[model samples]
Target chain A: MWDYSETVKEHFFNPRNAGAVADANAIGEVGSLSCGDALRLTLKVDPATDTIQAAGFQTFGCGSAIASSSALTELIKGMTLDQALHVSNQDIADFLEGLPPEKMHCSVMGREALQAAVANYRGEVWQDDHEEGALVCKCFAVDAVLIEETIRANGLSSVEAVTHYTKAGGGCSACHEGIEEILTRVLAEQGKTFDPAAAPPPADKSGSAGARLGTLARIRRIEHAIEAIRPNLQRDHGDVELVDIDGKNVFVNMTGACAGCQMATTTLEGIQQRIVEDLGEFVRVLPAQAMPQTTNNQ
Target chain B: MTQAPAGIYLDNNATTMVAPEVVEAMLPYFTEQFGNPSSMHQFGDRVGRALKTARQQVQALLGAALDSEIVFTSCGTESDATAILSALKAQPERREIITTVVEHPAVLSLCEHLEKEGYTVHYLRVDRKGRLDMQQYLDALSSKVAIVSVMWANNETGTLFPVEEMAELARSAGVMFHTDAVQVVGKIPIDLKRSAIDMLSLSGHKLHAPKGIGVLYLRRGTRFRPLLRGGHQERGRRAGTENSASIVALGKACELALAHMDAEKTQVRMLRDRLERGILAQVPNAFVTGDPSNRLPNTCNIAFEYIEGEAILLLLNKAGIAASSGSACTSGSLEPSHVMRAMDIPFTAAHGTTRFSLSRYNTVADIDRVIAAVPPIVAQLRRLSPYWDASAGAPLAEPETAFQPAYA
Candidate 1:
């Protein structure tokens, strides 16, 4: 239930191109049964035109992964090999409308398998043994190229946005600084300027009439509570994030550790209430129910 | 919601409703006999005797030498943790531990934690049908290995492990062995005296008893340390106020298990087999998980490959069938089951895995209702699936040749 876009759901539920080609020139297989996802691609190429005449795939994965594979297949079907080669993981993500942050790897897997398949067809070796580029995210096997491409395609303007696309800053957050560097480099290459002085000031700090002192204090108090509770939440398979502070109504979104928890409402009432109460009665603590639902399974 | 006359209670592996007999046995301890077992009054003595009797019942079920060896714990998790911590503590110098990868989280998560603590942990891989590699297990065990913990039967697959062989190997290595018998305790015959297992854990709710009560058996003369440290409850092993009511219920559950085991196993096995065969014949790509010959009599793990397990479970729940998905735990991590991953089952298959564990109460009519209702559900989910194109194959598509890329 990761709030998959309508398009993503459409492709996932009734996917296009989900079978094997009868006569195919090149095929690529990536991922493993251990990795919890696997993609097998078959392509029938018109060698004279160097264009794919037919394409099909079978994916052994979840809804998102399967959708990514289906999208990848549809994108490249009946296209020239060169055109197919330009189809990036970002294109896959975009075609599906958007994927959940963690699930960008599913699109990445689709892209990698495609690239590998093309490489296999051409009998060409990859120029760089880029394995030594440094491990960015060990859990998901994400690397520098994946992050750079994700940042460029998604228009990731911040460290947090980069995390949303490539999951580079998601796990452990040990590599946040490294991901920031990569993001900076990608943005710079795209001629997007980043200036500390030019950065917009915090909207809350603008001291608008809508911004109440109680709300600001409650927000800060909730932030401290979230930070304190973060580790325990991670252990319990969930996480929390501050969504918004509209006057005295403090809104927070719960994910990972809190999602699907029977005690989620209790956690909000008990813990969030204490923070708001300490801030003052002018503040009202509320879970951000209006936010897009991101439950793991719908 | 309109309630349907207390719907037929199957799915015992998920959890069993507390038995009325067990409830009757527990009623006195809740009110009249409310004194702490440690109190000096005769009221305390009465509750203390209840605890002792419960311990003896559990011990008798396992065929252990003494009731002193059984430790009453809060739940299966605590019992598992106690056994593992004690084993690791006793052999501080030995850093390696061997265990099956298909164990429940109660054991597997502890192994993961121990691994993070710099202990060398070997996960014994299983076959597609979820049978452990005995040769790999023997090869993994050594003088460096302190303990080997495996489940008596898999919760997801219901595949019975070769515990007797595993215990023998551990015994020969002079390493302590523990088995989380939560799923297998009442369903399968377990004789601690005959087997080389040093420790075992069982939960009360998995059987016909109440929750919040569990038994952890330690072989006599085993070098073990207590996990909890406080008052002299549980013979200084688990030092918490005894849940006297639940303990009495658990004892009654044990007696029921012993009396009904034979008839229950035979009847439930037949129903389970009928359910399995009906599904396989009716639904495309529907197959049972684990070694069919070595599975529990009252459980069936079926994978209807294109659909998600949660979706199917939801559909089943709507149809008044209480089934479980190994993929969807109480915690909302939608990752395919670790148990299925350990068995090297493909994620598509793993995502589709659904467990239906039966009990003595389930009947052939219940199985028939499931069989009648399930095919349509599977078909509906498949219609939503990108993978289940009928043109692909009627049944038994070649796995290797099945990966067709739809890309140009």
Candidate 2:
């Protein structure tokens, strides 16, 4: 459980200005039920003063989210629309005394809603054409545009921080790689470089000779290694065929003397070690009988 | 000052208060009987006797034929690891595992690790009611499977799985079967002699015993490998000196559980039903999450539409009532629990799921307090919710493909 501050709990329990202003002129809406949080900010602006006369919110989320939205209303009220535009999510969190790192997205939602409200007041677009960007987090419905915005706004370098700021990688985590890619690109655009080492090891697509060989070529290489070792195995009246190759897995069928042999494990290990020595470290040779083979052998 | 006031606790599935008898049973071991059971002195003799009695107590509760079959470990996770890893090590030829998608993190996370280590894991799916498909399970028990590990009852939903029948099926296929019965041990009756479960895992804390102690029940002559290899504690099946105090407490807890088992099903079931019925009557757009008739007696998982759970929980906390949620906000994740997601519960409702688990210590007044405190809270949150439609009993703007089941 989070060690939420008293102020946060108070604001969440008894939120100030917690309903849509029926007579409000400028309105902003962000997030969705699918994202697990949403906020609708209604602002009544005094046209003569160009200031926010009243602010109200309808939030669909957690305690911290409601508190953030409530805090946003208090912070932006009685301020010029221009001044309210500069109220960051950090400022909302600060008003609540603080939010948990994981709940920081609640404050971010408040900031986004404020931006949208101000944009509506100015009759300007709040963000780029979000539809043009591809969806990155299907679970939260967070798209690349939102991910990039959060990454740049917070200078986020890690997937965890991105989740806290935008809730992009906080779901099934299937979109972490996509989030990392966006973070790298956005940081690069800002003339800042993310530490690649801090990220998960990239899929081995370095095009090194051993790593780049096509599946058929890799299979051929394994067969060649088997041919070299066949003479020694034939001395024991045993011959092995390349039954299948699946990623790092190499399936081999041992016939004649090797079939149902008591030394099958030893021979399989010997064959696997020999392949690793001849082919690469990623290769793992197993007896075809050990696992049901997915590939057919000629 | 931020500490929550003493209040009604309906989150027993998360952890239970240590029973007074269990605490009394453990007090002696902490000071008077502090000797290591492994030592060759008189002090060790007394400690060893206490350990034996504790094992017997747990054995009696589980209806295992012998006390020696039980091996104590640090917690449920350790017990689960010890059993599953032992099966893999004992049967090195088999490379496949069978488990459900709704298992606790102790089993799910371990299966993920095993998969990374090249073991194929077949995650059995559950129906909308969170019940397993028998045909899917039986078909998964092929010759390639080393072990079948499934939880007896789901922690979040309280839905019980047909583990005894599943274990029998695995036994016929010559496959090892293990059940993480941490949630079921105290609440339900378990007889290893009558069941085909080769191994079972139980945690002390879930059964009113203190934390830091768990048990792995291995049927006699079951081939096994120790997860922690060192000293000859637990008859060489587990290493390191015994946690003498917690072991004694667990034994006392098991005895208490066995004594209260009948009342738990009767009185506790009554209290749970009262809360469920009351809430359903008071709150609009609320429904149960699992097999209503087949779940554990003390558990009730209800989902409220149009309002998230954390907001509800916070209001409840202010009212001096405590519960838990499968909500993304509570879990510190962007999605709700995997159990709810696997059931394909509508995202709008899933985010609002809350679990109220009761214990024997609770009273009817506690239930009454919760029933009264909850309706107003839900009403307030719904009023503040943008999706809520006061006239219609649903969200005003439901997602395009929320997958609302007929029952929902």
Candidate 3:
């Protein structure tokens, strides 16, 4: 159901270097169980060479999170602390072919853990945890500084994208407005414009995500409605054939018993009503002969 | 195009495999008996009788006074919509609806819509064991309440609610009562004629029948309004052509369920308990959710601490096992299930909740396979869990762990 990559499944099923380094010099942890993902990275450093001698990770998360952590470990096994810090979330995802866009946060967690470990190795305290910036996503305990950094680093322009990258707006969504404000402020500072329409709102009770469909989607939905209604129409020894669609008008041809029958109007009306209900009330249905020019284009 | 994957399915709460008998009973209707039940011919007459028989079978299963009480619909959601909306329509002056916070989305989503439409909905909370507090439920009921729609059993935790008693209370208060019995009908006995429940909704697939066929049981004397008002289908209650084949399948499935009710309770319950106990014994920091003493016979919701559920399910899938999880990550959301949250389950343990729902089709060997496969998977995930410090035998590596609130 998740469309997880085979490589992700592979690493999750057989995770390498899974567990904490017993006596590691540096340990970095990020995320929490409440956020649906958490990761801890333990790095053993060869101080003379300034290289990561070994890396072990513990991840409490979904398959993608585990896979990303495994990939992070594999990527930074022999790299120096600075080199390991340069391993982006993208690198972890690239190691596993790719992760679903919604699961990108897992890779971000892996990269954050690596950075925290590197910061710890250098005797530098990670700047988060005590930031005075107000908390935005209370569900995930994500505060303003981290959200700003993630938005700026990823050039995130939408709340959904921010959630995917930071696991911030993914819970409760009470902080959606807060996330929007942060996005707008961060994008403005970077001289980039934020588009509010890029991400759609939550689906209504009808389960329809978008209020209106594009031209292609409208045509597809109309065709699907016709497909569903065709079999029932055949039971009455009649059939409806699509001729062409122009603007909001759907042109069709009625065949067999429906062609010149007294009930032809009723049959046409049924088709028109069904199309309108599925597409929208603005849709108009008419006979192909009534609208000839659109037929030739088809 | 390919062979079906061989796996042990334990996701019955999500949906169950269509019973072979139901399939056998439905095959003819798809071919020769495929006539509109509204038609004026012999073909139509045959289908109409089949529809009547199907209604009768469902009526028998629910122990309703008459087959006329059963109104067939598209699915559980449709049945739920028809019931809740019908109640509100019947009592236009009543602006409040009483329901539990742990209801399936079918009811919860409707409540949300109703709330947007200027209706006050009381989402009664559940305790740590996912049980509704009776005192709180009683406090929520008032004359302004149009309908009290609580689930007979929770889908997530399989916790049984006191629906019969609750319905009686609602009846005394002059409020309509509906129960989404989707998770309970086939797994347990129901005698609606003896209960004060005004309406009940059930899905076909949950009872080993095909999907797309559901029933709304409205009592004979109940005031109601139709949700769909087109054709004179289901006595003009629901509109649309009858899913004749599925209706027949549901009837046969109900008959089969009635025949196997004892085994479902005894053998399936035994298997479920064994699996739950086995997993708890083998895996540390794991505990069952809901009232362990009063839950559905064939369902178990277990939370494995430190490790997340999706990772465990993935490994289980690799081991040819099928299950579901309550984790937000599993659903592609950021928060765990509302049911778990309502019960105040710790965010740490909630993320790792897995639901293994059994059906009558499962065997002892299947139960054994799950028991044998779960420990290793838990161990593997725990190994990769930052919270799980095996040497300490407790959750570790946290400055927040000290502040983490304990929840049963």
Q: Tell me chain A's TM-score in each of the predictions.
A: 0.46, 0.47, 0.47
lDDT of 1 by residue, B193-306 (tens): 888999999999998899898989998888888999998887788888888999988998998888778965788898888988988888877778888888889889987885
lDDT of each: 0.75, 0.84, 0.84
After the best TM-score superposition of candidate 2, give how far the Cα of residue A225 lies from its true spot, in angstroms: 53
Where does candidate 1 stray beyond 4 Å? Answer: A1-298, B1-10, B328-331, B390-408
Task: Give the 10-residue window scoring lowest on summed lDDT in candidate 3 chain A.
Answer: A200-209
**Location of the lowest summed lDDT over 10 successive residues in candidate 1 chain A:** A199-208
lDDT of 3 at B212: 88
Candidate 3 off by > 4 Å: A128-298, B1-5, B391-408
For model 1 the local lDDT of residue A173 reads: 72
Please write out the lDDT profile of model 2 over residues A1-298, one tens digit for every residue: 6778988988987899988787898888876455578788899999899889999998889999999999999999999998988887778888999787668778878888888888888798776233213467755556677788777775667776676545566657898877877877887898977775685323233244355667677677788878877776675467888887777888889987778765566567667755765565557787777555354341
Deviation (Å) of B269 in candidate 2: 0.4
Model 3: per-residue lDDT, tens digit, A1-298? 6888889988987888888786788788776456687788889998898899889998878999999999999999999887887887778888999887568778878877887888888898764342223467756556777899888785667876676556576657899977887888898898976788875322233334357687788888889878877876665467888988888778888887668865555566557656665665456678787886444443
Those runs of model 2 whose alpha carbons end farther than 4 Å from true positions after fitting are A32-35, A123-125, A128-298, B1-6, B390-408
Task: Write the residue-wise lDDT of candidate 2 on B123-159 in tens digits.
Answer: 9999999999888888888999999999999998899
lDDT at A279, model 2: 67
Q: Residue A263 in model 2: shift from native, Å?
A: 57
Docking tier of model 2: it is: incorrect
